[model samples]
Target: MRVVLTTWGSRGDVEPLAGLAVALRGLGAETVVCAPGDDDFVELLARAGVAHMPLGPTVRSVVAGPKPPGAAAAFKLAPELVAARFETLARAAEDGCDAILATGLMPAGARDVADKLGVRYVLACFHLLGLPSQFSAPGRRPGTPSPEGETDNRKLWQQDAERVNALYGPALNEHRAAIGLPPVDNVRDYVFTGSPWLAADPVLLPSEGMTDLDVVQTGAWILPDDRPLPDGLEAFLDAGAPPVYVGFGSMAAYAPKDIAGVAIEAARKHGRRVVLASGWAGLSAIDDGGDCFVVGEVNQQALFRRVAAVVHHGGAGTTTTSARAGVAQVVVPQIADQPSWAARTAELGIGVAHEGSTPTVDSLSAALATALDPQMRARAEAVATTIRPDGAAVAARMLLDGASAAA
Candidate 1:
């Protein structure tokens, strides 16, 4: 069987699909990934031994570019990108594919491609909040009004749908028209099928209040990481008690103005060493101290196991990785589904959610102190033991089984 897994946005968006692609390959299925042409994504897919077909420029170029465009400017380019995405995925699956699975925004194009080829299109989501749930709120935008009661939440969701429609609906319909497909009335409903697969660790995140949405929770799509830590990092880990691991994976727009001093000071207050990841923000150690270590992208699955606690931007991938490693966490959420992840972490008693994105030395120290507590660490370890590691395999089997049944 052959599969094409397409994704966009940050590394977090690409990693899960890459894991699924690897799992498909392991089951003797040819898999190709359509992702952004970012070098980081290229390196990640290469390491996983998956075939990568670039769709367009990486999110880095658009978000962190020297002349980053405003919302209106970026929206102006959406139609072309939507059209390009449809063209790219169609080509990737031209050789005949069993399934085309897509995640991230603008999946309607992928759906159209699948319709054109008479193949099944599988829509997968990493965050549970993306789906409609009376229990939880929708993925919050940067400055939207918070919903109050159940009625308010429902209205908020409807409002959110309107926002999505106004933003991407026109472009989506334009592409559909170009391909002789009928325009969709509800963009959100069109992208989110009647049933969508939820790729998240069930132990850490479970679907609730799923009214009309029949979500298939296939656990988190996590790739097994065997890459050894860099020599310098390994030496640092060997030299001291596991440091408090701090890194906001790939939140380019989540610019926490002074994360360096805040995180380092907070960790130091707890008498813990620090391992700082210089993500897109270019965070670095402020002082020349041997107790601190600075690093670029490394293996979180391996590194989290050695850390005393994990502090991050509460991305789905990072949250799951830290939970699986059985380490306590402190999540400083900036936007989107991050606040939800942070809330879940705190609810599970395995971590503390920093009040807001910008953390002061004292605020982060308090959060770290809570996470460093022995009881919380114990709960994290217990939860880790229950986290299933076969989400990719389960999803792969489901795809192949569907193809077999159809045949």
Candidate 2:
């Protein structure tokens, strides 16, 4: 069977799909990794030995550039944002895959192709972005919206239903009409994984407004076991009591040098060593930095094991990694779901969430000190032990089962 998986976003988004592809491959499925429009990520996939098909340059332009002015008001202005993705997915669907899977970002395109081919497709989500049931995690009230202002659970549920209807509803009908297949009545025709409603086994997840059935918690898609650690990472491990790992993936520091200086000072204040991830985002070193090392990408899994504390922008991938690593953290959330993850971390006793706006040296120093506390460290590790590896094999089996059931 052939499984075509589609997704979009940054490395965090693309890399997990890669894990899914590898998992599907192990299940004896010929996998085709199709992402909306990210030529930039093509090399990374190639390096990982994954087959890929890029959608279109226009999709790339839209995702990479700033959101079109007033996109919220005029969806037409951002055709590529919601509408033009079908053209890209359709172009890819001509190959005639057996099953298509889509991430939350590009469901329309996946739905269009699945309807055309009369094949089954599934929607996989890494997190409960705005789903109704997602609000039940902890500080949630029924019928109330997320306190974060991005969405209210009540409004988001209605909006999600409407968004799917207005965006994917018509495209799917047109594709079905051309292919002589009847249109679906509701958006639920597309199967969903990682939501609680359809999960075979109960997992700890929010339980408020979630309504979709046919859901399965495929576990968190994470890096495979074979990804080798970066060279010389061992030296850093030996340098001191596992240093605090700090670096915001993809988000460039406004002033790496200044940030580095501040970070070094903070680490010194807390009497800890620091390993700064020197990624595309410029992160500099401190002027007084004696032993602080600014290095490039290291195997996150391997590196996380060697760290006592993790300080990062609360990305989903990073949050899972830190939790699984059993390390305390000082979360300095930048935007979007980062704050949510940060807040969750603090509430769960993984560590203290940095308060206020931008992460300053003084605040970071204090957070780091708290994270290093013995009780906090023990709690974080205990939580990590419970964070069962969302087994890749299980998710792989589910994908294969979906295809086999369709047959």
Candidate 3:
């Protein structure tokens, strides 16, 4: 079977899909990763030996570029961006492909393209974003009870659906009309069609009340394996005790240097060694001194295994990696699905979630103190034992099975 797996966003988004592509190829399925034309992602597809086709703007460009002032402003602008990018997605999916499996970031036009092509369309995601749930909502404060009741939750979901329609409906309808496809009133329903695959561990995040959506809780789809670490990093690890890993994945947009300095100071205050990743924000630009090693991008799986604990921006992929590594986590969420994952982390007793979106030295120090606690370490290790190791393989089988059934 020939499958086109489409995804966009940062390494956190692309890595999981790349892992899936590798797994699909291993199972004798011909897979192509339809993503942004970024060098890193293109090289990743090449190394994995999966076919690649360019689709959207590179995540690096977006992360490195200027962002809107507030979350509301960013949210308001998201639909226009999605609409603008739909043509590329349509072109990628309209080709001769057996099926199209798209991440949540893929515009709703992907579903229309798959329908026009008369092929299967599947929605896959790492976070619980598109799936409707009364018990939880994306960006909700962690550990807070559902005060508004199911009616209120449903209303909120409907409001979200309406917002999506209001934002993207015009441009989406224009594209639909051009393609001779009928316009959709509910964008969420159109985008989240088919048996959606949730690439998160059921052990870590169960699917108790999510029966309403045709969602599959495939365990966290981690990258296949680790790449070799740099010689300097290897020496740094050997020179001292396991240092705490501090890096904010792709969310270094605002003030990376200040954040890095804070992390370094906090680690110093605790008398702990630290390995700080530069990530997209260029955190490694900060000078390295005693007990601190600043480096460029490295294999997260390998680094997490050797770290005493992880302090990060709480992306879904990072959270899962820390959990699988059996290391305590100190989540300092910046935006989006981060707060939700942070809440889940604290609720599971695997780590501590800082109270706010932004982190200060004091807050990070406190969270790190909790993370380094003996009890927290033990709980994290226990959680690690429950994460399924064959998540990518399982997801691969599911996609292949769906294709075969459709055939």
Clashes of each: 1, 10, 0
CA-lDDT, candidates in order: 0.84, 0.64, 0.77
Worst 10 residues of 1 by lDDT: 140-149
lDDT of 1 by residue, 1-407 (tens): 88889987788899998899888888899999999988999999999999999986677877775343566645655655677678899899888987788897556578878877777778899877667766656764322344554456677778777766766678888888888888988877777888899898877777754545988889889988898999999999999788999898776666587898889999999889999999887889999988899999899999999999999999999999999999999999987789889999999999999997899999999988889989999999998999999999999999888877765
Strongest candidate by lDDT: 1
Give a tens-digit lDDT track for model 2, residues 1-407.
88787776556677778877877777787877776445446866776677887753423344323332233432442234334445656656676677777774535556666766777767776655444444433222122333365555555555455555554566556655665766765553343433422211122233234543334565677656556665566675786777878887755432223556676778888778888886545676755554676777567887787887888877777888888888888887765557777888888888778885465688778888899998998998898777646555677787788778887
For model 1, the superposed segments whose C-alpha errors exceed 4 Å read 65-70, 140-151
Off by over 4 Å in 3: 66-95, 137-151, 254-257, 285-288
TM-score of candidate 3 relative to the true fold: 0.90
- For model 1, name the residue pairs that clash: 200-220
Candidate 3 C-alpha lDDT tens digits along 1-407: 88888877777788888889888888988887777777877877777777777765566665676652444544544554565446655565554678888884636667777777788888888877557777655333222234455456677667667766765677777877887889889876788874677888887677656635878878877666658989989998999888988888777565334788888878877888999887777776346476888877577788888888998888888999899999999888777778778889999999888898667788789888999988999999999998898889999898889888987
What value of lDDT does candidate 3 attain over all alpha carbons?
A: 0.77
lDDT, residue 304, candidate 1:
93
Candidate topping TM-score: 1
Residue pairs in collision within model 2:
132-209, 132-210, 133-208, 133-209, 133-210, 145-152, 145-153, 194-216, 198-215, 256-284
